[model samples]
Target: MIESCSGIYRIKNLSDNKFYIGSAKNLKLRWFDHRKLLRKNAHFNFHLQRAWNLHGESSFEFECIEFCEFEKLIEREQNYLDKYYHLNVLYNLNPTACSQAGMLHNQDTKLKISTALKGRVVTDEHRLALSISWHKSDKCKKQNEEARKKASLSKLGKKESIETRVKKSIAHTGKKQKPHTEETKRKISETKRNKKNVNLIKGDIYAEPS
Candidate 1:
């Protein structure tokens, strides 16, 4: 039932009887998330979205196959996928029967994703929201030295596009910046000396030169 929902859920297409299985920490929240996406015709899974648009929301059903603790959710979900694994015409878009928790995509998978996402357009409003959320996110607010180092390394050798630069400049047009204190400047200088891969632009004290 909805009151005590958790663990695995199945979204069944009543029209064809095909379905997809998934796990969540809170079943109620996950159901609403899927419903919102399907209603907006913006689900990440093209197969499911196409079905929803064709059959409409009334032709679908949300069923809780079972409930389990949060930690057991992935294992249980994997079991479900194995039970319903198909060779062809499967409803699931996920390539694996395993959970995605703490998973780092392999280079091949990353390249495939990058290729698949080529020419995808993000709306300006969505881009602005993402920038604001990333800056204000508490998840990275207390990053330790290791986390900070890893973050910096991941962004190494990346270059911003001219359009991105223009957008950033326009966004910062009226913003006032405070000068770095002497101690901050020393740390900056020390970091520059320690890292040979960094590029520094002439006038910018924050980022390396372009």
Candidate 2:
């Protein structure tokens, strides 16, 4: 016997000839939530919910309890729906959105993984090659070291948060920010570029001496 909360449910809306696939850690609660949404007529608020309510007929049917990890279960359910029912052809990102993430480290994690592996999987030969390559390549070694340092620092100190950064960026541009000017660009470029060299260069570098 399988518990309702431990697996996925595939629901069919008979009136519209469309299907909905989803996995819930607590399947009973999820279904109950859906029923509540329908009862309250909150359908038009979201895409799938809207479809399920407006086009759906009375007496929906569901198949219960396929066992797999949450991500794999959602994927399997979606595959079944797509192959047989052919409902959600566009923007079906249910499984993709289920991935675990440390928001602060998501980009860094992806970059580190891609930079380190570049589509190569680990095998005995690959491991040996990697051992050899790690010693041979300064760039790889540096990247590995930097990644490790960043990870360690993240553990030790309070990392700058993605949410905070987004809020700060929005605040900086709030309703009345001025556009960039040529003088502003020149000042910025001068500040970032070689100040000593620019100061030491011949008189009035911006002008061509006649």
Candidate 3:
């Protein structure tokens, strides 16, 4: 029976000596996740993904290099990375063995990614999933609120250039606006009633201080 373990691991391409080094809390599960993403061509490490695509799965091997405690995982992984990185055989994009919190893509990589996604259309399901994921994360919510506040502050007293206004007008010209559903209208009405500031006269909706 296979046992769960935490350690530094290596994904080696037999065709070439190039390999990716990583550390995981559960090596087996981490390797499984890597294979799944590589097979789907959606691996976060594009360098490794490209290598896997070129070399084929049969030519690669996943092996544990050192078994270490979870606390020392990053340190151990960093040592291995430092050793192999000097030889230029690593598939890792970043030389630092760390999480992707502050990783910035180079201009070339950013351009390549932008070009690749330029014509891609997000499906409604994918859009909904992204929205749900964003909403579910408190960190994301806080970041979004901060960003919005910063944007509002930055835009305060800013006037649009005539050229910019013209471009926006052209962009919106002939665009059909979707009407809100009855449910949405009902929710709006309920919110207005709760606020006690909204007034309805004839067919116009207005807000007045209560």
Give Cα distance to truth, residue 184, candidate 3, Å.
Answer: 28
TM-score of decoy 2: 0.35
Writing each residue's lDDT as its tens digit, candidate 1 over 1-210 gives 563455888899999988878887778888887887668655656677778889989999998988898777766886777677664445775534444456465676566557756787766644554554444445557555568899899989999899999999999999999999999999999988866444543335576657
lDDT of 2 by residue, 135-154 (tens): 54567789989999998988
How do the predictions measure up, each by TM-score?
Answer: 0.48, 0.35, 0.48
Clashing pairs in model 3, backbone N/Cα/C closer than 3 A: none
Error of 2 at 207 (Å): 99
| Top of the candidates by lDDT | 3
lDDT of candidates 1 onward, in order: 0.73, 0.56, 0.77
Ranked candidates, highest TM-score first: 3, 1, 2
Under the 3 Å rule for N, CA and C atoms, how many clashes does model 3 have? Answer: 0
Greater-TM-score candidate between 2 and 3: 3
Q: Considering only N, C-alpha and C atoms within 3 Å, which residue pairs clash in candidate 1? A: 199-208, 199-209, 200-208, 200-209, 201-208, 201-209
| Clashes (N, CA, C under 3 Å) per candidate | 6, 0, 0
* Candidate 3 deviant stretches above 4 angstroms: 1-3, 100-210
- RMSD versus native structure for model 2: 19.7
